[model samples]
Target: MKTKDALYNYCLRLADSNMIHGQRLAEWCSRGPFLEEDIALSNMSLDMIGQAEMLYEYASTQSEAEHSADDLAFRRSEREYFNCLLVEQENGDFAQTMMKVFLYSAFAKQLYESLLNSNNETLSGFAAKAIKEVKYHLRHSSEWLIRFGNGTDESKRRVQQAVTNLWRFTQDMFEMNDADAALVDNGISFTTEALSAKWQLNVNEIFTAANINIPETNNTITGGYNGIHTEHLGVMLCEMQYLQRAYPDAKW
Candidate 1:
């Protein structure tokens, strides 16, 4: 692939994850455990969507055809998206949601931090702005995980179950293809493989503090980058794309 196409795919990978994950978080609105927490989730959802919009806009510019951010985000079929499988999984429960956030935020923080040194000024600038938000995301989710781990025996069991269930999907976060290779070679991005060790270390630290045990599993799941998603993503896009699909040129 050309370098421009590679960069465009990279942006879509980031943006698609944010858009889908944000959609999941939006499900928490008016449904949080409490009012304050509800508002917090909504705000975080907005943050994720905002970041996705920025990325989609940048990606749009790299395309040969004229397409806006909305077009890229809403007009694509489920198979065209390149987000990690971890972000597309259902938010099972409050504990499950927190666990998912902690895992993804840990990976995202590392990914964005690496972008600080990117040869592309646009990516580096986005990283500079996004790192602050990602830190808060990590911290918030970490605190919730700790609370769940240290609370009632029931809470501990639920969270432990979440860890086991979600652990398999973690490997998907590091999956890469030619787009990643091209970006790495051009100094516009680093290899996802390089982030694995540090991601594990950081995760171990948080798990230790939370009194949670990391699952011992050799099994790995992949293919989200190649757009071979679990069944959930197609169901999600139906709702997310409904308006745009129904009214291709409709405007407020």
Candidate 2:
């Protein structure tokens, strides 16, 4: 990447999104619908956190800043985070959470699939490995969405509501900032607009089988790229960052 800062920022965007989403999934550690599902969510949480760590490590190598991966992962203030609005959303219910994951995983699958050929070797390798986990996540979440859609009346009601409530944030996932434009121009990153189009197709295919209707509109909620997040991120960060903040140098 010619502009190191742009590449670094892009990596932070990817890592921050993964870390926050993983933390949200970890909230279901003991609260999944069943024991098997509980274990599944925990595993997914680990997978996302691991991905985040790898991305952070790569970013650290590229950055002149002294922030370690842990510092980058935990020390940044809320406004410094560049995650999409989708991942940081509050987990509403079983259906809502699954829908959220489905949307993100679908995007990740296509984004990484294209990134396998990135000019940046570190990013290309990361995409190759991360795509596998993303595929499983897409499959898992899509299956649950189908089940919820075809199940009892209440199940159908809840899942549809999840779709309606979360639809706006979906558009924000593709909203790119200057750093993203710079990386894309330099071939260090893929264009999220193209990725977003593919993601919508995948989402439509799954939603079709589930008999769920997608709301069509130009009204999209964004600003996460600009570091403006919903109230949910602040809450999650407070809880997740408490230990690190309380003892800045705490070590095991």
Candidate 3:
């Protein structure tokens, strides 16, 4: 029973992460710096929303309530969200957005790779499907990172600053809790500790290729795992849950 609960929590975390990030990406729908990028980010947003649906569907199976994937995603309270802090951070400039995408895609790619071998069949299946999508996400983000980092002086300067600003929040992505412990013990989930090292290597490679240096800041902002998030998440939740809250049970 404990194992099942742990798995359920793990699934919700994954679902929330994708759902929140997808919604944020969708904000770039018509605002992308260029047409090609506009379509690209929109496509990524759709992929994340699709992945969130799969994860939330799996999570709903573990609950007694008849909550659908949309309910779990659109109806949850702010404190109920378990996504990492990185996803909720404000999309600053184009460089900032690219930095967010690069860092997150790198982490997700490594995590999904490890999860593909999880002992739990559901988790393994989800990871297998997500890995393919995240690979393209990584490629897209990496290409943009390189372009901005090595582009004109103003572009390079902005991307470099973006990288520095976002680095502090990266540590939260590896935070583990009791659910993670249980999942690790049951061999149903990969260890964040193990993934951290690989994530560093992956990010460093991209930074090197882009001729951008990882920031030297020692400050790390944590807390999204335990339900403590930034002010930005509240605004995001307000926008995301507005219709659901305003029109309770008014589904199409």
Best by TM-score: 1
Clashing pairs in 3: none
Ranking by TM-score: 1, 2, 3
Model 3 stretches with alpha carbons more than 4 Å out: none
Tens digit per residue, CA lDDT, model 2, 1-252:
347988888899889999998999999999999999999999999999999999999999889978899999888888999998999998999999999999999988988988897999999999999999989999999999999999999999999999988999988888888887788787878777778778879998999999999977677899887789998898888998898999997999
> Every model's Cα RMSD, please?
0.9, 1.3, 1.2
Worst 10 residues of 1 by lDDT: 191-200
The true-versus-predicted C-alpha distance at residue 26 of model 3, in Å, is 0.2
Quote the lDDT for 34 in model 1: 97
Q: List the residue pairs that clash in candidate 2.
A: none
| Candidates sorted by lDDT, best first | 1, 2, 3
The TM-scores of all predictions, comma-separated, are 0.98, 0.97, 0.97
Over the full model, what C-alpha lDDT does candidate 2 score relative to the true structure? 0.90
Candidate 1 local lDDT, 59-113, one digit each (tens): 9999998989999999999899999999899999899999999999899999999
